[model samples]
Target: MAELQGFVFPRTATGRSSILPAPPWHYSGDLLTIEYRTDPERVIELLPDPIEPADDPGAVALVWADWQSCSDTFDELLDPVRAQYKEVFFVVRGRYQGEHVSRCVYIWVDKDYALVRGHYQGYPKKLGSIHLTRPVAYGKAGPRLEPGGRFGATLAAYDRRLAEARFTITGTADQGGFVNSHAMLHTRFLPAIEGAQAPPSLHELVTMKTVDVDAGPVYVGDADLTLFDVPGEEFGRLAPREMIGAYYRQVGATFVGGTTVHSYDD
Candidate 1:
């Protein structure tokens, strides 16, 4: 007979801490993205100073992803459900410091654990329901299988449809030369404690950070996007002029650290 050890773990307001685990967090999964051209004026209105919309057709990309993520501290291999979840994000292409970059405008996830983890990394993630449909085969099995298939996903918040997208898979290709941009930028704000006389004149601060990813094999495809009536005005502005392209791919990244590009006091 095996004996179990009884131990108590520290807890916070949210739950157990998943941050102190360690480095080299591994995330492997499929990402289906739909790209759309938008008004350059609207894109400019959304970007902060030192960031400008890309010269090539100002575009926004929506991504639907299902991942199996783990870290050195918590090998999800032991319990897959603990680390597996679905996510969706709306991003815009922009330029920073003379380099093309992508900035996340909004993001949603189905799990609280993922929400906490993303927030710590400066990703503006919010709690929502995301459903990503797996790729389905179209024809016969084996070598006779059709060259293309289909993928789809939907995102909802507050019991309302935020957005939904469908993609027609064409074939697989190298991760390079794809419309999917790898560089990302986000802003983080630390506000001064209100009515704290002891702290005196401590200033509120805001900072911008960028994250770059090296993607793996990419699946090329065509996509269609449907934007629904959401609470935010920004969501309405994202209505696609036209879908430029779409692609699917498996991704892996080691989130190390970020550089603070800008800071402002309240």
Candidate 2:
């Protein structure tokens, strides 16, 4: 579900101005990976002083999302915007019931609209509109289904609730460190269509890292991510930085990291 998880919400924004400090953690590398989206020129402006690409560093990566290659027909509409702004990102969530999931995304902001392309299970959805909203509801992030089963009703309600909510990128950190973003969205857990029961619990871990550029020792973060399955009521929490580290000393991020990567798996 890595691919799908990454595609969960794109081009949405929350206007709230709140900052949460990055959880204290350590990784082997110093390089940082981010879900970067802004005008290419703006990126250059934010470059650190004495701006020079790392020696023997990796390629200056370009983020691009494709709406045309999806199983879902909505992609065609989203492709046009992607052509304009040129935003792309990838996320790789871990195994879910033994299946690997990955998420890929493309985003662009234009004079008249915000365009976004997302892929999951090869199904793509593109959203376009004149006035873009940040931290848009996850329910509004993609296509919606017509009310059908109990699960369907449940999801519809979740979407309705998320629409009026708010979110903010409180802070961002490196692989070895932690990122803390305060997001409020109506969330629910749906069972698989084939009678599979929902996992006893649900967890979320967002990791951003690079692969080859600043490679070094790896260290996991320490803070836990809290997932409120039912808003206002705590459903569950995932503390991978601690849980994973407890088992493997060197599994997390390390300083002088290599490449940029983001992940969110169920």
Pick the lDDT winner: 1
TM-score on alpha carbons, each prediction: 0.78, 0.19
Model 2 global lDDT (CA atoms, 0 to 1): 0.22
Kindly list the per-residue Cα lDDT of model 1 for residues 115-191, writing each as its tens digit: 76676565778888888766544544312112466666899988889888877667776652333464666666434
User: For residues 145-252, could you state the per-residue lDDT of candidate 2 as single tens digits?
Assistant: 121101100111233221111112222224432111111011112335555554423222222332222333322222222222445321111111122110001122
**Alpha carbon deviation, residue 78, candidate 2 (Å):** 19
List the candidate 1 regions with Cα displacement exceeding 4 Å.
1-22, 136-146, 175-180, 195-216
Residue 203 accuracy (lDDT) in model 1: 25
Global lDDT of each candidate: 0.67, 0.22
